[model samples]
Target: MDHYSFFDRDLSWLLFNERILMEAEREDVPVMERVNFLSIYSSNLDEFYRVRMPVILALNKLAKGGKQEKEDVLLEAQSLIEKQQQKFGQIFTSKLIPLLKENKVTLLFNEQPPNEIQSKITDYFFSQVMAFLQPIDLSETGKNFFPENNRLYFLVSLTLKDNSKKTILLNIPSNQLPRFYSVSSDDQQFILFLDDIIRHNLHRLFINEKVTGCYSFKITRDAELDLKDEYHGDLSEQIEKQLLKRDMGMATRFLHQPNIPLHTLHFITEKLSLQGSSVVEGGMYHNLKDLMGLPVSLPGLRYSRWQPLTNDQLIDAPSLFEYIAQKDCIFHTPYQSYNSILRFFNEAAIDANVQEISVTLYRVASDSRIVNALIGAALSGKKVKVMVELKARFDEANNIKWAKKMKAAGVEIIYSDKALKVHAKVALVKRLVDGRIKYAGLLATGNFNESTAAFYTDHILMTANPFLVREMELLFVFLAKKAKTSAGYPIEFKHLLVAQFNLKDRFLELIDREIENVKKGLSAGITIKLNNLEERVLISKLYEASQAGVKILLIVRSICCIIPGVKGMSENITIHRIVDRYLEHGRIFIFNNNDTPEVFLGSADWMNRNIYRRIEVCFPIYDQHIKTEILKIIDLQLNDNVQAVGLNENLQNVILEKHEPLIQSQQEIYHFLKQEIYDRV
Candidate 1:
């Protein structure tokens, strides 16, 4: 039996956010990119409160017998968030502000505008921002007011001539207009927040009354959709209804300016019936996420851009099918172009031999060329079946809209089973090649969205291997018929690792094999790269392997619960996390099966939700060349001391000591892929 100790999941996630903040603090990073990291941190926190806090809140409610476990977790999360927020303010104010000024761009927060830009700011406000202002008298509305979720607003205190005061609520039209307005004056550029512009003109709205104070505030509501387990109607319809109710869910965090008076805060909370714990005192500006859109275009202030490399194999091929037929191709995205994956579908749409197209859509781009190709295939009389998962959080509407558009174009649309979400990123194409049906499939570790593909590090395998293609066909057939079957129906996959079927068992078996190899005095090890590692069963297995002298290396990007470097438990295990210009989103697993290693890459992470609840696929890397390429990439990441942080005994992120040459994995991988293109040429 493996006695296990686990880090709290939410706290582990917060540590990842801290790593992001550390990037912002790095002097070597470009100034604007540092500011962008701040935006990313703020945005991540908003989502954490929206999504994860509700679960904690529910657990708190369910702790009926005075059990404070959930409450303690929430309090710890709150404390950690507060500390990070302070660090954010310090970095922004002390470091980034000076850097921006040196670069001749000014980001004005709560200060008075310079004399040179005062008139321009006033003129721009009336011309662009005045029409969107609608101030509600909060005293008159009393308890009847509700702020929209995540929207920025201001609470104003007005002083009248009769020595009386009134409070009003005004919405900052950030959604309708750009949050940062750029103005150039006297050869210097100025970026002002929409909140500041509204603050400057608060008196203009109330002509008779004097505006005493205007403070920014925003509420993050519970974003969890309340979809019941048993629903009679369509899942898409149910999701649409739930999405509408999402905005009105319980307020998880009520963030107000720290300078707001105690009386005002009390009145506001009382009016909204908010609990004391829900109120969080924040900065003068609520939504600092707007910093990402700061209109500064200085050349050296941003990170040097690199164009995605064109895959050598597909660049000159007459047809993607022909190119993929001769050999399997792997696309390492953001480093390599996503065009190869796009071309795969584009060719299938136009190819005369193509007869069937099937793919799973979890979250797609708003203007997806993949969907366009599927529509084209359907219109051209080819059989097209798309399983669009409508339950992808925050993307439900976009997925549903695209599903309708494809359905209107005569494409067969498949909705996922209500009990499970189809999280796999796999596609299958059948073509009549030389009078026989040939299968070409796409299995990826990321979504099919081109927008994210440009910046998310993922792997896509385009292959014509019969064994994998046959299994992919079976998986899609299972997905299509999943709604009609009983819950206990077994799906046996030989070539693929699928969740809720054989994925967990296969992982345990693989670990056990490594343990057996170690027992037999043969070399054994495991290397895994995933976005998260929170499943206790798998962690225990890895611990068992470590106790048996099997080495393990993990590159988990976020939410790692397993504590590495512990004595007698996981001493042989090491965990490294990398955060860089590109998000590390791929899942790659390598097992040293007595020198003849086995490698697999796919969309599934070692998380409870991914392994037991969601429908995911992990496909084997059969092509030895592709497996070698993946191993090389993994080696590059392992050698990354610049952006990689090792997990210490306390699960804190500590910068790995630099070796010679200071290798950054993302840059090195790009160079490696570029070299491969040159070598092929």
Candidate 2:
């Protein structure tokens, strides 16, 4: 047997999703916040069915160890989901609804509108909801109406004038209208679902028929995009073509409300060609992700808001570039404002000294200020080069839109090859200052998205370090050539640890160094924070280090395959996850180099795709102050007893026991940065 064990990646992800459900069930969590978690849980589970369930089903079919084994695993997985769904129903109907009713708002789940608001509901349905309704009769033979993926539809069962059963599929119109309809009558306020609104008005639509049942349902299709010839044609065009066909992939799950008749269920399954798909019996609601539309402004029902803090140096500096040239500075987002990073690009766009700006964009925001800055820079006769990864899943259309806009504005847009994706979040600005070509850069642990910056916890670094900036420019040049090289691109990256080249090797060397230090009776440890951890080579190296008496601490938010606290395998490894108001997204790696620590931050997670199929950049921290700040923040997270939960050998997230002072890391982080600003003042 091997010295270490690994959990299945998909099941590990399911465990992470389960943690979200657990958050929804927490009484201490603000009721609206708990509702938000419920929405997030539903959204995440839907995506899992779209993306991962197809792989699981296919593997089960092709398993050589008899279909019985795979069948048992499937049944186990199904059982887990059923229990979660039951819990979801209990929490939403029993706990949350009553809690909201106490606060003077009524969310009509399965119930009809109150007698006081009956006429108003009828009027609103006629005037506002009728324009978006396009119901189709299933008895029609040739019209071929396909149900889109994860879209809400109601199977209306009717008894016609001839005393025969007829089924019609009517859309919930959530895409066009709001998922919720909020109305008030005197002292009481009621929130209604569009699904319930339509269900209440079903009799008016079928005047001659008796409406028996109106049940909610949806079909979740595989989200895998077909890009077979993506490398051949225009990459953006190919993605555009594939986006049209994405919703038509094989059905992975067919979810419906529990009260549908057997004949109606059979009719939908056969007509939609979802014969072998996993059919789930659900509550009256199909997509509870729509719960996010609920009002979060209810007093005492939401977490207290903390305004983002500004980087004093960056904001007060007369020249943002000059301050960075003097010393490297870093900003933590959601805790710190994103204006400093924005100023980085906004300054480069109009600066007369700046000649060229180049960057790699993985997921561009829909309304991106950075892209607009690049457009302005290019239009101002400055050379702007952008490598936009057309394969950024689910955001392909948005990225393609921005790429075309940038290209049209004279900004050179480089499309990454189909086989390799450049996931480096790095940007460089070249300036001719004082008759010298000066280089400055911005590196980050997340995408350059201002929208996500409001909620995603990330670290952004601004530096005038010549070596790293020069290496970033070299990377842009290499990416422009499609990154096609026989032996790792021939260029040596000394400052940046780049994947597909020195990344894996350098990480192994780091882990091995810790193990060697342990052998020397020196202080040795490895602390890493990542969104996911699945690459086996680095995991095995970590296991080897753990066996050599190196203490490993990990803060993984999701999808961790490494099992911790296993006897004789990973006894020294401690892993925990922190779920809070904002997403824990930053990736940090710290190596205890005999008390003098080394820290690195990057966008790369040690997943299989990051190691082999992508070009990721993880950069070392040379500035002492920035490194210390990162270490302190990570230390706070390590000591967090409120939001953090430790993982056991069974891959279960166990709540950490609270001590004298509970450290909620995100809250503490905010205060820490606030204190730093105060100290600087």
Candidate 3:
């Protein structure tokens, strides 16, 4: 109820998520894609429960101990989510299902299985689904029936011959079977939830007992892993132990289908030892994120794929290494193909001249071609060093899997201190050309994983700049030693802004420069694009710059904590939140140095985690062409009316009024680059 200088980040995050729901509401959006938006909204909300809900619950209890600002925030978040869920249901039933039916696709939402498909559904239930079902009676199973976090389960009530009541828990094997079953009859397609198929055949499984009622429910638990400030043994082993217990964590949410009998709800809650505060009422579907599994059968309703553009210059180049050796280049993915980035690592693996390669991977793809290249590079006798952060949340298992594979293949594996995480997306390849140690570096705003690169918009700079490449190598050296902190390390990063050492200070200095230029009556402005903005010190400095008359512009994709456009404090500041088809993942900062603009891009988000807890790299853009292209892209985003929601002082998304030549930044940026790749690259 009270206004603070900064908005609560969690509350701001909830608003950003609501924007996804807004996309789903747009009539112009294709119906199938709209369904995907709904899926994303559900997926994002589930993750919010797993990751942030625990903190909210803890802080609310602590609020009782007098922090007191938000038990208010906790209640507001719950109420907001409740409203969003209702709106989600309305869209699903009234709008989306009607649209689907009009397109000759029946989603079979809350409705029963059509009589036509009953035989087929029953057959599949016995032949395929029955193998995965494990039914446990609550009375007989006693304390052994534990629900895994976020997994869907049906609580079925059965009536016995003796008139005694029984509750049974049936697993929804969505993990093993398709979440939805598609069947066609009378020229219409019906999509059935796997839950319904199993629910329909409940009587067959229970042959004698009458199937009285069935309700869906799932428990979301705290996902936090507690690692000591210092690890005494293997960090991977310690994390593996914690991961086994992750699903067993205390319940943060107990979401159930609406209108279950009160006694059943109470009995289940009591049996599970679920907190009273954790109970949440929901529609029939618990994990609607599985809606993504729905078949996209209509060609007319599907988004016309934008073919990822090719860097024609590198297409026929004899060697990717030699291409970078000629000049510096910036590669954008999903707009520009990720193949060039892939070929960079691929080339290094085979080139006889290449001697060593080093890269820091925060999150590696399950089938990472880059990691495979590293394995080949090591197999070919080239020295390879990789710092795989096993602490990348939700990605620890995949990263550990790759790390062990690389390690087994003789690649040197380096792990950061338990207290610190390596969040940098960078790589260095060294070659012996003409008896000289020649270096080429890969610096990007996203991970090296090609899986995410397909959808996440990120910038990768491929350069042979010795100063920058060598500076990157120094970072790898720091990781090789496994220094816990920057307290004793004396690496003066003149070009790279690395966290725990110079990143925070360097950013402050840049903001100070803009503030001083404003005082000198010169052209002064700052433009930054970040995924999140929560570091208070930097935000305060930006607030100071705004008061000093520096025009500040921000394009933050999610979780902005700073209060923008407030009188005197931030009157000269404006923030835009953009959500669209492709994720806007690049982080770019441009400061108008009087007249000439300076650009920097990297992995850091300016959040508290990035500023103090992780090793992030934000590198300067020295190439004139690269700087101009980045500025053009940012300029388009800043001017965008479509897909851009400007945040008011209250942290509400106010749609930008459309102007002449309406620009959707993602679509326009792609065309702009596609045109350039043909005209200039």
Candidate 4:
């Protein structure tokens, strides 16, 4: 590892956010969609400060040398973020504002209304916003004024009649009401921030006080929870207790308006004990994530709606199990419908042949149809077991609630081992076929949550392959018996790559095989698509292979630490990142085994957490047809020029220049899968 130089993970993540910002800068994108990109950039940055900043802070608390190293990284990350924030402000003011004006929509930012809409704004503020206003005197609540995580607040500089100034912290209530209030005035549509509405009616709230100034601010607290594996108490209860403590965590970021007077800023920071926090100067609006919910409806302002296509195989089959039993089927989500996944659970619940079902629940939707189907199966007296990962950060409460519901419904809910999270997205169904036991498995590169399926690019393989399904059953049995056995239980997997056992070594072996092929003067190439690639062990292996002349093409969506195109280190490795309408959430790895390629897709990335700290699975694409389709899809993404950017040595997203034929991978893949439906018809 010392022989390799890696990019800082935090800095690399900022570069990824910069790519999302670049999408807003693209002129070809629809105006509203560009606004959505800005919202995504803002939302991503907020999460980074909440989650990743805490890790850096913890590292800084270590010995002197480590403290200095982490402090430097923190400074670099902050500098990059400041630059991105500046670009966001420029894009919003220069491009999006003017575009909205041209489309007969005006977003009023720091400007007085043109006298016609002032009355309407005042009326709306007094009626709607006044009730939610509860300003706390910071002088009274000093050091205990807990700014709830990620919520907007207005720090008011008030002057009383006696000329003594007092500061009040008021909640903006953006959570309770819409961030953008729409006002229709004589053929001209206008959108105003709820911040401005509150600003306009500030005098009404403080009757005797003279409001000298008001500035917007937001606080992002550390969101990481400390849930120890006590082995004595219930894991769900531990998680519930930690979720309550999330709001009381250390404040990581305090973002305030740039125009705040130095004295006011000092007062707020000192009173709130935010002396060492990352205090950032931002625009008048702090949480621009609200921009995503902008209430404006205009023709062609948004991306053309794309409906997920129904899979022809599932549509025509008399039974989903029967279809899967014949051949392996793949569903590329959002492009192809997720109904096939729903059908898998629904048919298993009602089909008399299904005797038992096992699934891994990571992040389930609030109103999960899959959970309903599992409950139905339990009510039907089928043996149902679920391994719900309760430590999926920010999704713990929802998972715990669903876990209780499933347990009450007689579903055997297996809580994840506190030491290892079950991040694998797999569901296994055991059915009695022809008086013998048979298995059907649904393995995917993403969660089983259907809501995310509508907007995430993932691949699900439905296979009744005896070898794979049997291995899946073995894995489930291991999970069911995990608590009873010691942590060192030897669970061997032959066909599938299981993390903590052989996934990491198996990947290394595959890469080494490519290196061996290159040594033998045989053709060797590696193509991988994953959300994050930060594990140094595998990265060093890839660098080694690159030196051996094994061409490596990586499509890493976020947090890639490996520096590509560096001489004597990773000169042959090329990294591309794709940020578009749908999140690129799938993990596909391909190795040219002496020209006969081996393709594998699964629920694991090369990140250390996924490889070492979680129960993940990466199964081989054994079926030739499905394998070819996966390869073709990866090829399409590799050749994409529309939404893909090359991650160069300088950590800049270099967009590939368009040739005669412009390739947008998502659209092309949709049409390609749509053609599959036509071919089947």
- The residue ranges of model 3 lying beyond 4 angstroms of the native Cα positions read 1-4, 67-71, 141-143
Pitting candidate 2 against candidate 4, the one with the higher lDDT is 4
Model 2, span 308-357: residue lDDT tens = 99756567788888998999989899899998888899999999999999
What is candidate 1's lDDT per residue for 1-681, written digit by digit as tens? Answer: 346888888899999999999999999999999999999999999999899988877776767557654435777888899999999999999999989988788888689999989898899888989999988888885335788999998989999999799899899999999998889887788888888998988877888999988878888999888889788977888899888899998899999988898899888888876773367888888788888888888898888889999856568888888788889999999899998899889999999999999999999999999999999999999999999999898999999999999999999899977768889999999999889989999999999999999899999999999999998998888888865432566666898998877889999999999999999999899999999999999999998899999999999999999999999999999999999999999999999999999999999999998987788999999998889999999999999999999987797999999889899999999999999888878
How close is every model to the real structure, measured as TM-score? 0.98, 0.98, 0.98, 0.97
- Higher-lDDT candidate of 1 and 3: 3
lDDT per residue, candidate 3, 21-94, as tens digits?
98898898899888999999999999999899888888888788886655347888998899999999999899
* Cα lDDT computed for each candidate against the true fold: 0.90, 0.90, 0.91, 0.90
Provide backbone clash counts, one per model. 0, 0, 0, 0
Poorest lDDT segment (10 consecutive residues) of candidate 2: 64-73
> What are the root-mean-square deviations of the candidates from the true structure over C-alphas?
1.5, 1.7, 1.7, 1.6
Worst lDDT run of 10 residues, candidate 3, spans: 1-10
Q: What are the runs in model 1 whose C-alpha is more than 4 Å off?
A: 67-71, 141-143, 484-490
Give me the overall lDDT of model 1.
0.90
Judged by lDDT against the true structure, how good is candidate 2?
Answer: 0.90
The Cα error of candidate 4 at residue 548, in Å, is: 0.9
- In candidate 3 the C-alpha lDDT for residue 574 amounts to 97
